[model samples]
Target: MERFIEEELAIAKSVDLCAVAEYLGYTIRRVGKYYTIKEMDSIRIYSRSHWFRWSRQYEKGENGGSQIDFMRVFAGMEVKEAVFWLLDFAGYRRIEEPENRIVLKNQVVDKQEEKKTFILPVAAGSNTYLISYLNQERAISKVIIDYFIKKELIYEARGYHNIVFKGNDKAGITRFASMRGVFDKEGRAFKCDVAGNDKRYGFNDVNENSDVLVVFESAIDLMSYMDICADYESNKLALGMLSDAPLETFLTEHPQIVTLRFCLDNDEPGRKAAVELMEKYYQNGYEVEDCPPPVGYKDYNEWLKATKLLQRVPEEKAVMKSAHGMAK
Candidate 1:
């Protein structure tokens, strides 16, 4: 068994907890002076090496500490394993000492790392459940859903019957996919990206000849926008998460795109990202616009539901009036 010295352990503990959380696929967001995880807001990252889970504090009694504790608790790693993983994450390698002792050493390598192969989930025999959920529950139009289904951009996955949204590269190769649950649980639908998803290739509907791009936070919201504006001709992208990696890649691939419209959610994090991205891309010389959902709506889907409901009111009233005239 390899053992680490106190100094080596200290270095491992000093690794940034926020970076570790992000690397583990948890979304971290800044709230006031501390950082909070998006999926589990009860946990707060106090500093580079310190964190605590408020929700577990009373039940578990002092439930967090340095990066070591974070890895052990959240990542389910052993003490020595956590230390080794942290050292590796911080770019340090283990040097074997005499009698099974391990010393941390900074080693540099010039070789490029191999890329992870992206594999999509197995497809369901048919998109029956997917089409019903999106069309009936989400209020997304069948015309729009059928269009994307025909393009091979949307499908139902096997087992869970998740709605899988695929993202393709410039050569039209699927490099990323995100899944949304067909059914809601506890008032929230399950959402997650597929393993080996390349954030640089976000789920998108691109018009190569168009010079404009409209960005959204999720694939459903992108499709919602399509239903709202049937005549829209510009490119559309869903980041899958609140990061600019996909936007950056899209811009690099399509040099013709000059205008950007951000349609992120009407929430704090969404607004903050929109502001930052708008300024950053504007400085890069692209025309940028902040086009969030209308007031009182949380997202484009919510807005679409309201718009659809209002459109049916007049028809409903007409039916009632016709029945009353017949009775008279």
Candidate 2:
């Protein structure tokens, strides 16, 4: 575990709570002098860096504090993880002591460590769980799933039955892999990167002949976009994370690409990232377009699910539903 000094903790706490909420993918709306999260309206943000969960206040007696507390309560991160996340969000990376040297009580100590190798998890005998999770639960089309499976970019891992999304370099060597559990735990699906996975090569479907690139926040979002826009032809890349390392690598590999479409989530973090990236890339001589999901939808996957749900409803019922929503 990493330890932080008092100054480090203070710096982390100094980060804006509203911005931290946005970084965690929550949408905030201004209500008079205070701000409330759209997804969880019970929480109110005020005084710049302070917040209060009014719903919890009745029971917990005013449950709120600095950004660290917000992370602990809302983001469900431990104190250390919350602090580390906040520091990272503020563009701070902690520099630890040299790997070979350690000082304890003014005494010098030395240690040796072995480097770890990158390896994909063992494959499962069948993709029954993977297929069902993607098609039935996620609403991703069978054709799109099959296309990626055929390319060996996706597979069901053994032991845990996780859906592993692999990333390959220009030479077709697997360099990165992110795993997603088929089952939901406490309403959240398990997700993590494989050990030693490289962020420079994110899961992607690059079309050498296309000059346009569509970027998404995750593999699921990328597939959702593909399912929605079946006829469109363009290169697609999943950033895996919000940073642009993968995008930069892809651009370096595919200089023919001139246009970029950022299809990140419509939430605060996604929107802010899209705007920042658009400006950065636009200044770098690339035509950039902000292609966020429609209003009220969080991400492409959610939008796809809503679209599928609407399609299943009877035509008259759909019209009536739209009319009712409009009336509200």
Best by lDDT: 1
> What tens digits encode model 1's per-residue C-alpha lDDT throughout 1-328?
1477665675676566776788899998999998999998988888546888888887562577878888888888888888888766644446675776666689676798877677888998899979988988789999999999999999998755778999998888998998876644112345677777887889998899899999999989999999998835899999988999999999999999989999999999999999999999999999999999999999999999999999989999999999999999
Q: How well does candidate 1 match the true structure in TM-score terms? A: 0.65
lDDT of 2 by residue, 39-144 (tens): 9898888755778887778656238887778888877888888888866654344667776685569765576565458999899878987998899889999999
All candidates: TM-score: 0.65, 0.63
True-structure lDDT of candidate 1: 0.84
Consecutive 10-residue window with the lowest summed lDDT within model 2: 182-191
* Structure candidate 1, residue pairs in collision: none
Residue 193, candidate 1: C-alpha displacement in angstroms: 0.9
Off by over 4 Å in 2: 1-114, 315-328
